[model samples]
Target: MSYKDGYKWRQKSKQGFKTKREAKEYGHVIVKELDKTALLTKDTELKDLTFKEFADMFLEIKKGHVTHNTLTMYRHAVDAYSSINNIKLSNIKPLHIQNVVNKMVSSPTTINSYYKVVSRIFYIAINPYKIISDNPCTGVRLPRVERKNMIHTISDEDLNKFAKYMREKYPQAYYFLQIARYTGMRLSEVYGLTWNDIDLKNRKISVNKQLQYVKGVITFEKTKTANSVRILPIPPILEKILIEYQTHELEFEYDLVLNPYKKNGVKCQINTYLKQFGENLSAHNLRHTYATKLLANGLDVKTVSALLGDTPAMVMKTYLHYSDEMKAAASNAVANIFS
Candidate 1:
């Protein structure tokens, strides 16, 4: 049986009664009892766990599951949450969480990230751990900031100029940029690419893994998600560029495509070159350009999502600027059919 406590719908009991009247009476009793007593009773042993202790346990549980970068972020959040160090898990309230968040001088995005880590810790404590009855992080209001699309894709004319300049001046940067622009692969995925993963004859580039920083050392790791491990088509222009690049670069370390450059500080090097073209572009902007071009040219969302190694929902959410235009075009096409 379930009951409504003003706006909140709460489950009263899982047991079934023989009659509707009995169920109604049982639910009423439960609601009255709930109003008189606490909604959730905490265990004596677990209720006394300090916020810092629970956070440490949470980090320990997350060690192997998350990437090195993600773990570092978690640690940073843990450090920021030291103000509530001695407070018991069940004793903490929304005001406590909100106070900690209000004290942070970071940007909205950074604060949000930290809040997420804290929120996850509280959530786990409520569920499987059962250390806390309620999540204190739930009702805390975050700073509101205007969301803007950060992708600064190159124009067709500018792309041509950028490509020519990179090819002539920085062959290595050109190779990296070409792979990223054509394939819509992430920077880490590109860093993980080797000669063996490239099927040049079949015109397909396999994305099996990515380069990740683990304990200050760069190493090969599984893709970000299961969908990330996919094969992308190599366009004719990209194929030509890769072929030339492969011929010139032989006997490299790990038989990798970009042996000398590595993963660290490569973005800075590319972005420095990007500034010369008079566009505020990063390595990821190339990927955005590729996906946007595909959607603008009339590719379906599912196909584009598959090609980009992301879910259709994520593709729609991220590329809504182009997707919205596509939606408008689709509406016109439907109207034209009736006409």
Candidate 2:
């Protein structure tokens, strides 16, 4: 069991106790040990810290462990819970925390995200300081939410219409869209593409890194996952397009294929251009559409998983759920085998 504000700690016995009574007795012994060791008792042995004070210290400690983006998000989450920030660290009850959570005007997911930061702050207050015991976020009820993907599958008719419209009205965005549709690359992965990574001879791209634009600085960061660092085989149509696009003479930043415009600049431009073809169309939507079509056409989930730099479970849950053909196939497979 984890102690409140105590490093989110877990204490478990390796071997199973022979009887329920034995287990209960052992647990009682551990509870006594925790009472002596843990700083959660109402006793005034140490100074009571404010939630805000402990949160600041925890965030500073977390800087080296998480990405700058993640750290920034956590900071924002903490700021969102400012109503209870001044509460005594040990005095925070579940009801007090729940009331603060209920006050958030954001979605349930966003509220939960903020609550995690608050919960962690409480956790750290228990350890090294012994200020509190038991997390206040436990048993908090969150509203049900349907997840909306930034990436949406475009209908085949819309896809064709967009292709024609983009080519005629926005050639630069069209090329970017084509590359994304053909490769199923994430926005950052597409931006990070270079001539060196594009193997024309092998017809595969070495997706080892991605473009990270942080604080006006451009850097090559590791791929989102180890699976994201695999080779992406280029189709003949895409290879032809890339060959022609490479010939465009433009000053390169970090040898990026889409030159002149940097990652953020190009991303904004591309999204702006997509508005004419489809309302709220994004570069990410093209990738989702690509994965949807692949799953619809009988492509195995495992193969699709690797192609999209996602796990099989994720591929099935996110992309395959949209494919009626896949669902039909699953039904037919069970019927045919059993009957």
Candidate 3:
């Protein structure tokens, strides 16, 4: 370990750590010890801060800035590091963080969430807190995440069956499903819609906000991103259905198009129908079906992204394989045109 002693670089040597990671951690310890007095604040000691203590401070600072959902995630992250709660900030090593990561038996996606939270805490400890110089979470190995073959979508025959079932059995759910299918709106966004958002005369639908479950209550919240707030052109089929459904609209306190009380049940029933078709699909599958069809039918990524209220980069990434198939079709068409 090396440090500057009043302008001249000085070196301190140590030995006997089992592995290179352990040796690297020991080196950080040495540097902290050598400059302990300088690192300490007037009101706080550099070596006295525990992981739990720092995490508490981090959460307290985060509470006001982040959403309720994000704060909940941060809390889960703090709980995930309970094993190392008592360990001093300066004493935590890559091995300690790695052990905690390995102990988590959850899915890779969930584990990554916890890892990100722990990493942020260590990052804060290194910066403004100055309690530690190195972030131990950097070298921790997380479980590998397996990517899916493709995003799931409903086949045309299955889609026709689904539409027929919804229309016959649950007229309200049928209308909701049609809007989701045609516009590719999220479940929350579809639930958030009101008659005011729909312009049957103009054939337009404005997506302004979304409904979220906050503190056990369904409340209005901003869209997932700024770009998520957009306007979509309503197709003729959807417009025809909306016109008929409008005649049967009932009075509701929230002025929502779909019944909030029965929407959950409707979604559950839709999911049940999909499961019977031999796959676990949900309302979001309607969205996937829409995007995949549009891409297959020659819509550009940028235009589809704008319609879906997502970035073109995100659209391409999600459907790159499908896009390649579309490219092959286009190539065959171009060759046959001259032939």
Candidate 4:
């Protein structure tokens, strides 16, 4: 045995530690000395934890604060990491995160969400658990997301044709599509609607809850924020449709106007029905069409924003694609002033 720098070391014979027990003892002593040195160097911090283990601990701590939807997204990100199969926690670098993000470029929103989850996990591991001295994701770069145009406008002629097609093919879903195109409500918001949420006397509907399908479970959750809880006035034509739909519901013994058969059915079923109508439009596209129509009709950005339950900046940034006639009308209005 020999001693150097407060650490004890031993030299074995030509066989180099004859028994497995001797090698195990040597390893234990070396680990103990390293722990002592680490303590003396700084605070006593936990060491040698794998990334997967630390991520689990971080998510456990985060579970109570976030919504179920958010937790599911985080779990998906962790699951994706596990599927990579070749990642080593100790050797993980920023490049690994970038590589994963690059592979998910087709889904920009999902990729960004995963990056946020990874960032949060590393943050908790570094500050709370002291699992690693530094976060490997610190300098990682996220993919650039190009925001797509959300405004989808149908001409009056096209809309009339669509309405006619709906009446012929999908009589049940026709009023639902009309309501969405007029009200600008999200698919979840529409699915969560009940008789109590509507005020026929005032020609308005109140947004209180949102329906979400997480892992195939249809759950009704609160709106994202108090600001998201809004009351939108129904158009006169839409009010008439609502009255008709209510009458139809009573006649058919259905609860919901759109889906009279099921109390709380999934909104994706509506999308399926729309496809059958030859419309090929999602519920969200109805909302987009609503906003575009409002913009084309000379409504100010703020009013359209409030009606769509979005900020003015979001409305202008996302849904300001105007038609040629609308653009020409604006030009003519200015030209008339000069004339």
Candidate 5:
């Protein structure tokens, strides 16, 4: 028998009933008991929903709290998963998830990110929505990822060569490189710099924001963090360069000090100008050059860390190879005493 409350019910005993009304009442009591039991049991609750519906709900709720860059990554992962296997929520199994993961040919880090997003969705469904009994991704193992260092530090000799090349080929870009080397600022931060941010009297530049091209439009946003917003002292040579550059900018009536050429008052594409010099280096290489030079000059890790807006540990980890050479030189200098 069935009840109007959308539950199936049945009589336990085969004893004959006195009337149809008595049978209907017995069916209602059985259905109420079953409904209570369903709430208590895990298996019954998990069988109610589809995986696709749960994922959609989770993403919709998460969209408001996350940044646009984070949302883009989440959307990419979810869309990729949905496109490959159109599995329903109730029918999804551990093996199905494993299969979908195996088919992905991306790097270990990327695959792990995909798994993380999916795992979070399942976690929300289980606790908050009460749609699933448990998270399916509980014990799934991810691939090990070895961190690869890809930064190339510009050497002093090479830096001089690059400067000369820039001077000869692109005079304006040469000054941009000079500021980047002295300030240890990121590419976006350098591009976003304005004349007002520079304190000629104090010989410092206040880094507060970054300029980026988003969706083919120029947008200015806050620096990555409170620590990232800093004031860096300008080297004397760079200060002279800036003074001359500022005068030039005023003569041309350009808003930005770095790249005077602009489209609708926005900074021009620096990378496009950089390419004319050569393929040996880029604008970002200037930052690496700054950090490496600091390490080479026997500067303490903490000081370099602060200047570069990184933690001391990160500075040690990334520049330790250079430090090792310094250690060897010091050891050699004291070898006569041991000998």
Candidate 6:
């Protein structure tokens, strides 16, 4: 390994690492011998390659870290930020990326997605590639995204109306919506349900795995978060639905709640139903709806978070949008205390 001015350490001297710890140890030694001050900073090799070239290498390295869907999204960010495609990974500054982001008039959420992916690209360009010393993405800022948190959730009344409509209009896949509405499961998690995962005798549901469609094949992925793998009581409504649903013949995956439909197919059907009724809903909205209802009804953030497969902090940040009545109740509580 050699440490040049811009290229901090080039492990090209050694073909590859035999073990993770050994490689990391060798890297730590290089850091001490070279900069000896701060952690891995951007280095000069960045100037040598175009962003496209760097991306090819960066994405290859990324394959081991991210999921296929995540990698697909990274690819999309590359495509969306067309202006940065030809820039040199090293010469590219934060301002250049910030300018490109400024021009892409889109939702804050969309802008954030683009910004994060680009940031990772620059991060790759920095340490391992040693192409640039400073991560340009660090100095860059995307437009602020406003969370329409309260309006985003479907009210309990609306959920009931929609669930009833779905049950009558689309019987086979109806429970999927009900599960998402009541339990706050992701579309994939809803699809992942097998009869084996449910315990009607005990009125409990175990959410340990998620079913997703990756590359057109039905895949079983681990739940998004460790918090996501929870056991929740079967709500009275869900209990009634599941008991009826249990009678359906799910020959292949006998225990799955949604045996008849794939993930996308279920989504398409739900969206179609929503369109028919002029309802604007998403799969995540159902989860959010469930979470919001729980929080709005005085359930603690921690409990709601577990049910929704998210952190309590995350639940408070994203789910708790109190209604006018709830806000008034808060005011009344303070007034009563003061009086």
| TM-score against native, each model | 0.83, 0.74, 0.79, 0.66, 0.64, 0.75
Using lDDT, give the best candidate's number: 3
- Between candidates 4 and 5, the one scoring higher on lDDT is 5
Please list the Cα RMSD from the true structure of every candidate, rounded to 1 decimal place.
7.0, 7.5, 5.4, 10.3, 9.8, 9.7
Residues 1-339, candidate 4, lDDT per residue (tens digit)?
233333546443223898999888887776665554342222322345566776677679767665577778899888666634344444577777777776763477777778788877776656655445456778777777777544445556656666776777666556666777779887667766777888989998988877665555666677755557899998899889888777664532213344533322434545664464346565567787788888777888888888877888877778656544567898999999999
* Segments of candidate 6 deviating more than 4 angstroms: 1-49, 82-88, 127-131, 155-158, 253-255, 260-262, 275-279, 323-328
User: Over the stretch 138-225, how does candidate 3's per-residue lDDT look in tens digits?
Assistant: 9788898887668888887887788898899987788788899899999889988989999999999999988765445777777777
RMSD of 5: 9.8
* Candidate 5 clashing pairs, residues 3+ apart or interchain: 50-89, 51-89
- Against the true structure, whose TM-score is highest? 1
- Per-model lDDT: 0.82, 0.76, 0.84, 0.67, 0.69, 0.72
Candidate 5: stretches off by over 4 Å: 1-71, 83-97, 112-139, 250-255, 260-282, 323-339
lDDT of 1 by residue, 159-205 (tens): 77777887787666777888998999998899889999999999999
Candidate 3 backbone collisions, by pair: none
The 10-residue segment with the lowest total lDDT in model 1? 35-44
The TM-score obtained by model 1 is 0.83
Q: Model 1 shows how many backbone clashes?
A: 0
Pairs in clash, predicted candidate 1 = none
Measured on C-alpha atoms, candidate 5 has an lDDT of 0.69
lDDT of 2 by residue, 30-139 (tens): 77767755555455534456777778888999876655667888999988878777778667789987787778899888887888877777776666566766778788
Error of 3 at 10 (Å): 12
